[model samples]
Target: MLKPILIQINPLDNVAIVVNDHGLEKQTVIEEYQLTLVDDVPQGHKVLLKALKKDEAIIRYGEIIGYANADLEAGRWVNESVTRMPEAPELDKLELATRPAQPLESLTGFTFKGYKNKDGSVGTKNILGITTSVNCVEGIVDYVVKIIERELLSKYPNVDGVVGLNHLYGCGVAIDAPAAIVPIRTIHNLALNPNFGGEIMVVSLGCEKMQPERLLNMTAENKRIALADEDIIQLQDERHHGFESMVAHILTVAEQHLEKLNQRQRETVDASHLVVGMQCGGSDAFSGVTSNPAVGFATDLIVRCGGTVMFSEVTEVRDGIHLLTPRAANEDVAKDLIREMQWYDDYLTAGKVDRSANTTPGNKKGGLNNIVEKAMGSIAKSGTSSIVEVLSPGQRPSKKGLIFAATPSSDFICGTQQMASGITVQVFTTGRGTPYGLAAVPVIKMASRNNIANRWYDLIDISAGDIAVGKKTIEDVGWELFEMILRVASGEQQTWSDRWGIHNSLAVFNPAPVT
Candidate 1:
């Protein structure tokens, strides 16, 4: 028999998560009987409450997670439990019930000095981005950015910076394929993003799968085409003269746009205009208990204020989908969640890979025993909001409510996609920690533990460990986080990632090729 250790989550939950590191090492006293140990278990893991038949449902958080693969004994550890059953929360005592529509209040009239675009979108920075359609032209884009940094930017006070958003996959994939569509949409979205001025300098090799014209069409209203007749004519003239002449010509043109971009400033906008992306990296056990819930509360506050909150990484949503599905705007949205889950399953199966292989070695060391537990913790960052829409990777939410974007669980990839989808700000929760930033968006790092925050104060924007110490409530931390978000959006604050120059990157969803 296993020794019973009291672990409580909620009053209604039937089973307590096993905190014992070696629950299956030997027979120990548990709740009911002197049961013999069945299998080895890890800490921050779960074990069965009773015997479960093959294909029987496994329940946690009082909801079905997945079904059993084989018969489970009372003392057996449930390894990667998979339950198909769906359980709904009791309406009377719901923690986050769908309440009646309340009149929303805007954030106290405060605004950041930012660029106002022709399309009514606001930009936190005025940047001149040189985007390429394929890796073949990445060098050229980089060269252009370097030239801008060296010559043009020195004269322009208004321009934030110049950058080349490069990626590996743009060709050798089917046109409009899932892989191709993501990058194409991402480039288009980047061009339309409010942070950049009306002018964009597009560089293409002319034969990539993601054509530059596709990007141009998306931002038809305000766009500047390069590598065309006039630009080619200019390039030819500069080459004939000398390299210095070419550099000078580029700088002169860039200065014009920089002057125009700098003229814009931030103005007060309603909170409804804000869209925030929730992300986590280097997560630990404390992630779910502290920073994640704190961010979740902020998520709820944003949604209540008629703003949008986006949670991507479909893989991380596996265990929490049940908890989230009930809050979907309708059955279709819930079905979309199911469809995405199935797609990931099929993707792994078709590739002849174990789906559970997605869990990182670091996760296991940090007290995350399996994907279910990690996912449960990851989804807590969304709080309790109705999923108003489901978006493919790189696609923006059409309606204003909580959204789920289908993306890979890798932090850089997920963060990149979130920014590409037009989220101007990101709240990255970490327990272990990573220094990551996006090209165009600002990331605010929130540490889950006090020790981590103290040790890496340079990289952490907020320490949410106060919740664990009972010094602050989740609501209090959330309001503080919301204020930080505003400050970041308004250009008043800088993230640790930004200070350290950690602009790690990944493109929108591009699936691995099936051999």
Candidate 2:
């Protein structure tokens, strides 16, 4: 028989979450706390440790997560229905850089074998990315990509794979609108990712609003591609060409890029060349207790090794902005963090909804009462590193170390924006389980509960859940994850997502009006 376990995160906490996989039944006795369960608390759900009157504050993680709806007795289940979410922290009243992070010891001698680009960026994979100017060419691009995989991929064993960077933009209703820059720059930067090996090839329909030249010249901060006339293949050109001729031309141009990519070789580089993104979805209560904290530990290690790490999802960070501002490297970076939060707040207001909409049914069922509680847990992946910089959606980092990339909380959009910002690998934590992956980079999945890890044995990469069962310490899992990151980045190991080929389609965040 299994013993019932309850985990209290802080000395001030009035509630503790049920840790046993099957939960504890009513009348169950816990000798540690000298209390009996008044209700059947489900796994990951919280149980009150002290009786409270109506509207009393409910505390967890040493913070007020919510307020009781009515008088609540001790040992009772406290779920979303019984808890009223507190208001978000006031952004204007926040103190900037009040408690900056203490310096961490240096982590040196970590390296990975990666392909080096002439622009000074290192890539974990060498791929030929085929971009498109408009959605009209999407079908053709997809078609030709299949043929290339079948015919040409085998010829170049050095190239990892080919990706057709197709999206639902170009020739749309409001291409010149002020907000249009979001998707446009996103598509522009996507083609220049390190994995593409700087072999920029675009299949244009020739009549799209977003011209090939304009897209290529979107930015100069990153080394812009010197547009070659032959690199842009116009399917609508007045040549003696049918569908087969177009396919033949595309295949020829792709082969040229492949030949260049195949010539590149992997060389050992320090971990400073690595850019990692951390995110979570389908989260549960143990997220903060196990997986996220473990990820945070690894995040700190990456920063210590002089690598770049970014954690995003704007709404998820909104409530925790107060906690993060003090850790900023300086006042300017602190303001930059606040600016992104204010922008997202206005964006949400324009849509007539608030951050409360962020929590899903799965999240509530997993013991997250509301967005406030979820946000507190979500920011745990940032670790204790100082905030070195802040970035807008799709904007690449100017400096290294820990960065805050402002992006939506949706898993797909967040992943896409992170990739555009130039992340070569991602770590995703989940408790409810997700098969999410991206074709452009490798995704490592971490599970928060022993049950999920055991049930989905082959799907999960690292079992942070063992911390919850007292089988492993957070430091043990942290070092394990940090080592695994180097191996995966070096191509010495394959994540389950890549091994199973479970790549989700790219989802661009288009806040502008869609025509």
Candidate 3:
């Protein structure tokens, strides 16, 4: 017998989640609650603790997750179909920072081996990134990247890789739209990300609205580079007579960057330079019970070391906005968070959708009934640390500690923007499983259950599943995650996602209109 186990996220919660897959059956005995099952319940689904009348609110995590649409018996299943979404919190009335951040025991003197950048930032990997001003050049860029990796990369022992930044922006769009600032700043900041070693090499089609010079912002000295102005490579230049000439030009410039990258070696630095991004997808009920909580613990450790940790995906956390405000670092940070929420609300309204539209079939199948339940699980990645800063899409952080970067809940878009914000590493949690990674950064994937991990053991870098079965404490797996972050950040270990070369293309968060 599996003891008919279930988990209660909060003492005030009237519902509990079944932890065992296919473990609940008719006449099940919940010895812990002394309650007999009235109906068959599947694993990862909700089980009511007591009877509820029609139109009563459903509480989870001590918050109104939803309201019952029909009367339900005690110990009966309460899933999405029978629940109605609760009214969203009013942004204006949300409270400001009222609780001081929980202090952790002193975490003195932790370090990782990294390559220091000219701007005083650091990188876990040394790579040569090739930027493009338009998608018309992507085919050639990919060809060049393959050739470089197959041939030139082998020659330079120290250079980790050469990744081509291929994106679908820069053409057929109103470049002056108020929202255009998002994509422009994204491309600009990505070029300066510390992992690229400050070597800006851009390839352009020469006639697109986004000129190479504009993308590179060449007018002002990029004070961050501290290097001589470099020449841009334009494919349409008269000097480049044919395709071979263009390839040769790129190869020559790439070798120069590879040579420079190979010269840089890793040195031990304190954890303060780390900019880490945290996210979750394909999440199940156990996401809150296992992986997210463990990640949160690691988040606290990173924050204590004076490092930065970003937890993004606005829609995924929108339902929990009321809880987040009091954790903001100050009144200004709280207001900024509200402003982002309002902006996103307006954006959704413009598209005739609401936060409820965020849930996916997979989310429902994985035991997350709706966005409200999903948000409850998603925000746990922040731990109990104060949200020290708030960033709009494509904006880099000016301070450290936990940050809330407002981005779409889409995994690809969120990951791309987080990379643009200068995160050197990302820890992704999934209950249903996803192999998402970024060419510009390292991604660590953790599974919430052992069955999923065992099936995709080769893909998942870490497993926090044991927390659900009482085999491991959240602290045990959390400290493991903290150590893994350092090792991965130091380039001593390669994430499974990195090793497999599994990556999603850049999906820029462009709200600008197409011309």
Candidate 4:
């Protein structure tokens, strides 16, 4: 028989979540708490510990997640329909640097095999990236990509793969607006990603607002890339006569980059060279108790080893900004964190919505009550490290430690932005389940429940589910993740997503106008 279990995160929490694989029925008793279920609660759903009058605060994680909408009885199910979300924390009144984080013990003597670049960046994969200046070239680029994978990739065994940086923001848009900087810089930085090995190439239509010169100039101005005119292939140039000519030109240029990439080999590098990005999607209530916390533990391990770690998703962190501001390393970083939060606040306001729109139906079905409840779980991926730096979308970090990269909550846009910021590997957590991956980097997928892990045996890379049932401690799974990251970074092991060839397309975050 399955053991009846209830997990209360904090002593002050007034509700507890069911932990059994199959939820307990009415009249079922949890001997530890000596409470009976008044209603049939599904697995991962919360149950009230005590009856409450209308408008009473509901607490979890020792923080007020919501208020009861009606007079709730003891042992009844508590979910989105019965909870009213609280207001977001005020940015201007937030405390800064109140409780700075102490330094963790140093972790040394750890290293991985990585490809080093002249710009001092290290890459976990060796790839040849063909950048596009306009969406007009996508079809051609897609056609050429298949040809490269089919005919060219086998010849260069050292080159991991070839990818075309495709997006929809090159034409029919306001190119000179201030907000345009976001998408423009994103494209420029995508080409400079460490995995591309300093070999920059671009495909441009003969006529477009975002010309190759303008696009590549951004990188040159930032001192990121230096390329000659030969590096760009202009389809409408007089040299190209027909469709065959363009395909031949692209293939020839691709071979040149591939040959250069093939010459590079992995060398021993310090673990500090690793730059990891952490994110979560399709979350359920178990997210906070299991997978996310385990990832947090690993985040601390990475920071201790002198590596760089980033956690992003602006709306997901907005509600919990107060808890984070105090952990900032200094006043400047704290202010920067607030600046990003404020920017997102205004952006959401302009769209006539608020952070409450962040919660998906899947999230509610998986047991989350509102955005307030979801934000608390989402921020756990950052671990407890002090915020050493804050980065705008697509901006790389100068200091090494935990960083908050301001980005939208969409999974594809977040992954793209993190890649633009120079992440060579990513750790993703999910409870409701998603098959998300990025082609430029290897993503390590983790499941928050045993049932999902058991069902998606081949898809999930790690299972933090055991932490919920007392089979393992957070430290145990955390240490396991740390070791796995090293192996994956060294190219000694392949994540399931990489092995199965599952990858999502790049989705750039464009808050700018499209006129």
Instruction: Count the clashes in each prediction.
Output: 14, 0, 0, 0
Model 3: runs farther than 4 Å from truth? 218-230
| lDDT per residue (tens digit) for residues 360-457 in model 1 | 77665555555666677788887877788888777767788688888778887888778777787889998777777876778899988787798888
Candidate scoring better on TM-score of 1 and 3: 3
Span of 10 residues, lowest total lDDT, candidate 4 = 219-228
Off by over 4 Å in 2: 220-223
lDDT of 4 by residue, 1-515 (tens): 78799999999999999998888899888888778888899999999998889999999988899999999998899988889899999999999988879998989999999999988999999999999999999999989999999999999999999999999989898999898888988998999889999998899997999988788777433544567778899999999999889989999999999999999999999999999999999999999999999999999999999999999999999989999999999999999999999999999999999999999999988889898889999999999989999999988788999999999999999999999988999999999888899998999999999899889988899999999999999999999988889999889999999999999999988899998
* Steric clash count of candidate 2: 0
Ranking by lDDT: 4, 2, 3, 1
TM-score of each: 0.79, 0.98, 0.97, 0.98
TM-score of model number 1: 0.79
Which of 1 and 2 is the better model by TM-score?
Answer: 2
Judge candidate 4 at residue 250 and give its lDDT.
93
lDDT per model, in order? 0.68, 0.91, 0.87, 0.92
TM-score, prediction 4: 0.98
- lDDT, residue 432, model 3: 89
